[model samples]
Structure formats: structure tokens, C-alpha cells
Target: MPDTASDTTTGYQVLARRYRSKTFGEVVGQESIAETLERAIDRGRTAHAYLFCGTRGVGKTSMARIFAQALNVTDEQAEEVAVGDAILRGEDMDVVEIDGASNNGVQDARDLIANASIRPARSPFKIYIIDEVHMLSNAAFNALLKTMEEPPSHVKFILCTTEPHKVLPTIQSRCQRFDFRPISVARIAEHLTAVLGSESIEADEAVVLRVARLANGSMRDGLSILERVVAAADGRLDAALLERVLGVPPEDIVKDVASAIGAGDPAATLRAMATLLAEGLAPERALDGIAERFRLLLAARVCGDDPALLGTGSEESAALVEESSAFEAEQLVHMIALCDAAGGRVRVSASPRAILDAAVTRMALSERFARAASLLAGDVTVSSGATSKKKSLKVADSTRPTPPARPASPPVIESAPEAAPE
Candidate 1:
């Protein structure tokens, strides 16, 4: 049987929509913003306009809907499920939800302004929730400015955008802006655990944590990933299933590449990288994995094996701590920087494989450069490892002429001249 949690008589609703935040308390990772809005409603200090800005899959749109429901639904009517449901579904007469991307013309703004003057049909206030507001055209924004500045007392506006910098400063100034931060990995993991429990899905802790890391700080994204895995699990979800389904590089492959780089073995590094590519991993993804591995190593070097900082399971953390011992913090930083630069180039390069290979090789050879730098800086004695004593570095100047065989015969004549002068 299909999972009843996601399937309904009407149809199947994706987990992102099915498990969306319905109340202020349900919103994850944006607790501060939720609290502020709730207080605003309780104190009757709600602003005429509110700007919710954050990355995709965060709680911006969800919060917008919840805030609208709070503004229009009274304590007595709150018990009436239909009223709250209609507003949440954007079907209420007093609450309007507009997609700024599609209807971003001047006429749309004029129509919105025209509708703003109408009082609420049943609720106390009429609220406009415009999503992706940054996508609205300049003329459309201009048309709404006057109304936004001096709208009727019964009208309220909630604007949400992933790219707030694209929004005009004038429009931004008219609204009370709230910035939503990316959810942390720990928070995402905890939320995913709860979601799995509710769905009656038994997922390994490692699998859940991997999904959370893959979500990259978006709760909605975390649900979507979990939903996909659950659909294919057939009531069984494990690390192996996740690897096959997601096609993500296995942890061992990434560890091998990291260990090779740390050992300064370019051949081994390339071999490990080839294995990853042979597994059908994209070059960009391979680079990302390598970079993330180095990041974990760096974190381990600096912070030890703290799970919170490393964002890995206990075994993975222990492995990272062990591997990080092979490299200094500075070497890891340089390796990460190399990966970052190569990441940008690989996207636009004609031969992305070559770029990735070059990055891997450079990372493997990074130790030589680090040693050279240390020797030049005279920070510490460097050894070639073949000798028991430290090796001294002597810099030769090519522009300066070498002293000829004059020193072989100069001592006898120089002593006689010095004695005569005295």
C-alpha cells in the first residue's frame, strides 16, 4: 500500500507541501522571525508591510501564509477550520497570494492597487502575499509604491524574495524586513528525524544525517530528499540504498582521495579520483566532495572531532580526526582554496575532466610548496626525511658573478701586503 501519510483520496501530495509549516511554532530554523511576528500579532503592532528574505526552500513563503492567517483569523473563528484552511490555501477572499514572477507587469500592480482599496469581505484586514517580489518589473514596483506607502488601514502586504538585493531600495524601505538564516545541519538532522518518525519510516541515523547534509540548510529540501528516498525504500532504507539512489560518491571514495592527497601521492590521488568518476559521479560533484572532505579535515584539525562542527557520524568524525593528522591546518586551507578556484573554472572550462585532474594533482603536490614556503620564511628547520639532520636552504643569485680561482693564490700575497702596511 502507498504511504497514507503522503497519499490522500484527492491525490498524492509531496512531502514538501504536505509537511509544510502550518503554524508559527512549526516553522524550523526561523524561530526568531516566527517569535517576532507572533508578538506583533499579539500586541497589535503588525506592520503595514513585511519583507521576508531568504534562500530557496527556507520558511519565507510558509511564514507569509501563517502570518496572513494570524492577521485575518480571530480567536473565535480560529476554531472554524474552514476559515484558517482557506487562508492557508490562499483561497480566502481577504487574503491574496500573487506570484510576482508571472504577473510582474504594470497592469498587475495597478490591479493590485485597485483591489487594495476594497475592505475585507469577512476578516478584519485584507492581506497581499507577493512571492518572489524581486521578479516584479520596475514599472510594476513603481505603480505599487504609492499604495504601499499609504495603503488603507485594512490592507497589509507581505513580500517574500530569495534575492532581496534585486529588490529596489525604495520598496525595501517601505516594509519591515526580516532576514532568515540558513538552517544548521544539526537542526536539519533533528527535524528529519522527527519527519521520519511521523511517516513511520525507520531510517538509520547515518542515512538521516546524510540526507540532512545533502539538504544544505533547507528544511523543505530535506523533506523532499527524504520523500524521494522513502518512495524507493520499499520499507527498507539504509546507507547502501541511499548511495545507489542518490548516486552520491561513497564515503570511502572521498576518504581515499583525501588520504592520497594528504600523503602527497599524485598518482594515488588521480587513481582514486578516476574510481569516483567511473562510478558515474560528475566532475563538479567529485570536486565538491573532495573540497568538503578537506573542509572536514580542516575543522577536525582546528576543533578536534566535535560532531557539531564536522557534521558527520562518530565513525566518520574519528576517521577525519585521524586523516587530519597527516596535514597541517595551513595545508588543508590551501587545498580547500585550490578546490574552490578549480570549482569555478571547471564549470566553464572546455575540458572539465582535465581541470579536475589538475586540481587533484595540485592538491597532492601542495606539500612541496608548503615546505618551500616554510624554508623561505625560516620559520622552522625542514628535513628531506632521508637524513637525520635538518636541511639548509641556500639561495643563489644568478645576476651576481661567481668569484673565480683568485682565492686559491690570494692568501700568500694578501698576508705580505697587510704586514708591510702595518
Candidate 2:
């Protein structure tokens, strides 16, 4: 499956290319659409133009390439290709893949238009697969529109883009639009398992999940991250080393921080910070990890009942989501904001430890910040609530109340010292 051989080039295929889906069957999370395309071709109802639309790493380009191969398919008696070795090769016959970002100009398109008049050189049909199709210039799109409106019977056009909304509706109307969904974590995990085992490299499931989680629903992005991790680890991976390499704050740290937050124990939270500092974790990174957890909690609350909508298939994250209800959404938002701001500052600060200390103190003590706001607003009810809370906590009455004026003690102490000097 790899394009590389010998020491001439890097042996590593790079996760995206190495694990690329050569066939519709290998495409994860797009089975229904793949089946539809297969049936369409089988039934001789295949459209001349197709638009594969989705976010990046969702297999838009890959599907376009596959369809292009399908147009020129000849290995089997079947009309469409089955993504075999021959189809995967994408030889210099009828199938062609072009980057739209660079070839979106009218001149380039005019060249394509000039060539469209010609018939397929050898294969059944000439297939033009254009990626990032939305990048085409207005003039180029206009030129494409004419061809798409009425193309030769032997030509097939496959347009792919992450931003299909930018594409002209005229072009869209002429094509069969297929939306590619983001790859699920389960799918990414499965692919990673196959790829890793093939390479004879063993890694923890949590490490793979972390790579997948950071990918943010992009299979290409996930693979890219996984490649980086593999390279950084020098072959074998340890959970702590992997987390450190990827800048992921450890899972235990996140859980501890969140649990401390739930219990409202500032000291316990500060102790957790100290433990991370002992582990050689930077204050800035620790803060970022804390922020990431709170962000996760925010997402958990949003997708309270729907695990699928969360776009993750991690059991730990699912458990985190279930346990996340103990904290209010506003609390997570508040902590996330604080951690983000603190992390930003800590990164630039010469004394990150001091900044971390102050940040934790700020978060812990900030609960009473609204008391001052309430006082200024002359809201008696809020002041009473504060007083009652302090009473419930058994803090001293003197400490709870606003401080009275410091009277004549200063003058008396100065006189006694002056008297001794005289």
C-alpha cells in the first residue's frame, strides 16, 4: 500500500497516505453513500458529474479519486472499479487528479476545456478529478459550468471540496452531491490498529485515542498526528512520554483537577498543581490541560444525552461526560476562561510558578468577587446570602463583615517609640 521502496525515500508512508481508503469499502463512516454510488453505476444510472463535499480529512478527495477510477474501470466484468491494486495505481490512462487551488484560473480551465473535446486515449472514459473545487475562479467556474451542463458521454467529472457552499449553484445543480461525514474515533482507532500492527509497532489504546481526540474529527489530521507521535517516540510509545510529546496534560491531572473543582477544595487543587510541577510539567502546559478539560466539559454538557454528536468514541471521555454533570456549565466556562488567560500569561512569564500560584488563588478566591459587586449595587439580598454562606462555613463574623476604620492605635504606637528615643 506504500508508495516508497528501499532507502531512496522514507520508509514510513505517513499515516494519511499509508492508511488511505483505496476502495469504498475501506472508507469509514460513509457506507450508505458508497453503496448508493455502487448501485448507481451498476444500474447504469451513473451521473456524468459528481460533487464530493465535506470537511477536511473526511475523504472528499479520496472519494473523488475513487470515482475517477470507477469511470475508467476495466479489470472486472463489473462497470465500476472495486479499488483493487490496478485501480489504486491510478495509472496514466483515463483517470487524472488535479489540484483546484492552483489550477482555478480561466487559462488553466481553458486548457482543460480545449482537451475535453478529445476522447479517452485508451480507457473506457476520461475522468477529471478536481480537489478543492470551491477554489476555482469565477471565470473558471463559468467555463466548468458549460461543460458540466452538457459534457461528452465518455467524460466523468468528480469535484471535491471542504467548502461546497462556495461552489456555484449552477455547477452543483448539474452534479450528484455526496456529503462525507467526519471519521468517527472508533473508525480511526480501528484503522490505527491495522496500520500499527502492520508496522509491528505496539502502542497503548489511550495513546491512540489521544491522537484521535486531538485530531478533531479529521481522519487525515488524525493520521498526520499519529505519524508525528510515532516519529517523536523513536518507535515505541509510553503513555507519559506520548502525552508529553503531544503536549497533552495527563489524564490523571485532568481528573484530579476536575474532582478538586467539584469539591471546591482550593488547597487540594493547588497540591495537584505541585504534583504536576514535580513531574516536569510546565505551569503553562498544566494550565492548558486544565483548560482543555473544562472545554471538554463544556462540550459534554452540550451533547448531554447524545454520545454520537460529541464526535468521540472514547470510554474515558464518555465517563467524563457522565460525571461532568456535577459541575454547572457556567463553572466550566468560567474555569476555561481563567485557565486560558492564565496559560497565555504563564507561557510568557519568567516566573510561571508564581503565575500558576496566583491563578489558582484567583480561581479559588473569585467566588466571593461578586460580593463586592453586590455591595456596590446595594443589593441587600446578595449581601445576606453571602453572610449566610460565611456563617454556614463557620468563618469568624469579623472576617465576614466589611472592615471598620483603624482609629487612633497608629498614633499611640508611634508616640511610645518616639518617647523611648527621647
Candidate 3:
């Protein structure tokens, strides 16, 4: 079952906030971390400080809130749903949610230090959840070092940062660190399906999967994209509607381009590129799609139709395995490299279309270059099973034997002619 909170306010709430995980078990894709935190709380071994580190939309802040709720809310207070709700909503006096980006100063740190000494208003623990903690200046970090190292028994700290590397090492050392991983595509897709079902919106599996892939392992991003789709949905969602809303080229067009490149057909490849450009797909995005296709193909070639490795459905995995046979692993690697180089140039190039065209053409003609390389490297083998070596070509009369000692006679005649002239 999907875990969701009801929004009673008249104002609209985005899916991300409305569907935020309220309990540790409701957290998606970070089950191990959630379980560990839950065990610590159950064992009465809650730490004084914790550092949550991960990329955006991967539940760092959400996990912090859930942890705080678990620590401060007891069974006696469980009957009081308002208390748990306040903590989860980050509105409780005990759970203070601070945006470090906005209040990152020595004074802010000092204020936090000063407030830590005070007791909780209602809850057992007074928790400070500082998000984007790496934004604090050096002086601010230095000010908080001692407090973070040794806070009052009633006070707890939860530090969250997208970039953990930027946080001072001394601060990190004092807290128990939990590194959150990016959600998997399968998990994101499943979660999206559940969300759509809850909203009574029906979407094609392909559409849901496409949105999940576009989310790129961020559940929040997946929800945001799905929100846009739901807002624009008419009746039932389909692939055409998805492509139209996202303004991306159709999957068939991308596959056509990849097939042309794999077949070494420059004209067909350019025609496919023209179609993509005519459809208003950005050149950089087109390049990304092509690169992604080749990446899947490479995976298929190496891993042999493993859907897990390809991150595709079984049908798509089979199709990729079939398509991958058109190009060798080495050719796919070279094509991917060409796409990467062109991608870099396309970002800054005034004529991105031209760059894309040239890149596809180079990929289409890659076999010719491979052949030329083989010839240059003297690797040509003959029918007699003899390998050629780099040497000067010579014409020899193999059928006839030549007389010996003619060089000595020629030298003697030349010496006699020189003596006569002297």
C-alpha cells in the first residue's frame, strides 16, 4: 500500500509534499537505513546527532523528519495524532527545520547553540534539522563544532546535505552518518503506479516506465513529472500524450536513428536526424537519446538480454538483444564515444544541428575507419593462413635461378677502366 497524508487545507498541495512518507516503513528505496534507524529507536539507543547525506529528492529530509518523529513521539503520545503530525510536518516546537542555505552564519550557529540548552516544549527530545548543512561558512561550522560534539541530553541534531564532501570533517565525525542511495528505476516505477492508482488516473505501463526513466532515480522528480502529466491528462494517459507533453521525440524515431547508425547507413542516419530535428527535439536531447540507446545495446551485447542490467522490460530487453547484433561491442563503444564528444561540442556550438549530423555520420561510417585501421596495422591475413608484416613490397622471379659471382667480374672491369683513364 502507498503511504500518503491527506491535505485538508483548501490550497493545492503538490504530490511530492502530499505523498511524503510519514513512517519509516513508508520510506521508499532506503529500507535498510530506515530499518537501522527503527532498530536503534526500538533498542533505546538513539544517537544524539545524525548526518543524512544524499542527492536531491532521495529522501534525506524526509528521513530526518521520520527519525525525529520516532525519537520524540512515544506510545503514550501515539493517541495524539496531532503531535506526530506536527513533528512530521516540521511545525512542532520540538522539531525545528532550518534551511541552512538561508541562515548559514556564525550568529545563526551561535543562536542554535544557545537554543540547544533550553528544554523541549512538549516532546522528549528537542531536535534541530538543518538542511543543506554544507552551505554554512567556515566560521559558522567552527561555532557549531563543540555543540554538535557535545549537545545537551535533551537536544538532538539532524544534519542533511546534498554534498557531504563540503561539510567540515570535524562536524561529520561527531554524528552518525547515513548515506542514502538513489532510488532504482523499478522501485520508482512501482511507486508511480501506486500514486497514479491512488489518484484514480490510469496510465499506460509504457508511459509510467518512460516517466520513471526520466526521473533518473529521484522519487521526488518522478512525482513532479507525474504531476505535470496528471495535470495535462485528458481521460486515460498514453504514450502519445506523454511525448506531446514532454516535447520529446518518439521512441521509434530514436530507434530509427540507432538502427541506421548500426547498419552503417549515413543517408538513413541523417534522414532520421532530420526527422528528430523537425519534431522540435533539441539536438542535445537527441544526442542523449542516441547515446542511451547505444548504452543499452552495449549492455545487451555484453550481458545477453539481462533486463536488470538493461533497466528495461523483458520485451524491451529482447528487442535490444536483437538490435545489438547489428553492431559489435567495439563498434558500439566507439559510437558511444562519438556521441559523448559531440554532446560536449553541441552544448557550446552555435550550429548544434550540424554537429549532431556530423556525429551520426561518423558513427555510421565507423566500420570503414575500423577496416582502415586494420590495414594500417599490417593485420591483413591471406587465404594461406599467413599473417602480413610491415615490409617493402618486392617482385621476385621465383621460377628462375640466377647465376652467382657476377658482382666480382663487374668490379674488376671497372677498376681496369679507371687505371687506363689515369
Superposed by TM-score, candidate 1 places the C-alpha of residue 400 at a distance from the truth, in angstroms, of 13
Give per-residue CA lDDT, model 1, range 1-422, as digits (tens).
23446465667788887778899999989999999999998998999999999998889988999999888888666556787888877888889999999999999999999989889988899999999999999999999999999999999999999999999999999999999999999999998887777778898888988898899889888888888889889776898888878888777899999999889999999999999899898888888888888888999999998988777789878878988999999988888898889989999999999999999998898866766677778544546574434443443344567778554544444445555565
User: What's model 2's TM-score?
Assistant: 0.73
Winner by TM-score between candidate 3 and candidate 2:
3
Per-model CA lDDT versus the true structure: 0.87, 0.75, 0.87
Task: Give the poorly placed runs of model 2, Cα more than 4 Å off.
Answer: 1-11, 75-87, 234-236, 254-288, 298-326, 337-362, 370-422
TM per candidate comes to 0.88, 0.73, 0.88
> For candidate 1, which ten residues in a row score worst on lDDT?
387-396
Query: What digit string (tens of lDDT, one per residue) describes model 3 on residues 161-259?
Result: 999999999999999999999999889989988988887888888788889888988999999999888889999998888888888668888899999
Model 2 lDDT per residue over 51-147, tens place: 9998889877777666656656666535344333445655555677779999989999988877877897657777888889999999999988788
Give the poorly placed runs of model 1, Cα more than 4 Å off. Answer: 1-7, 76-79, 371-422
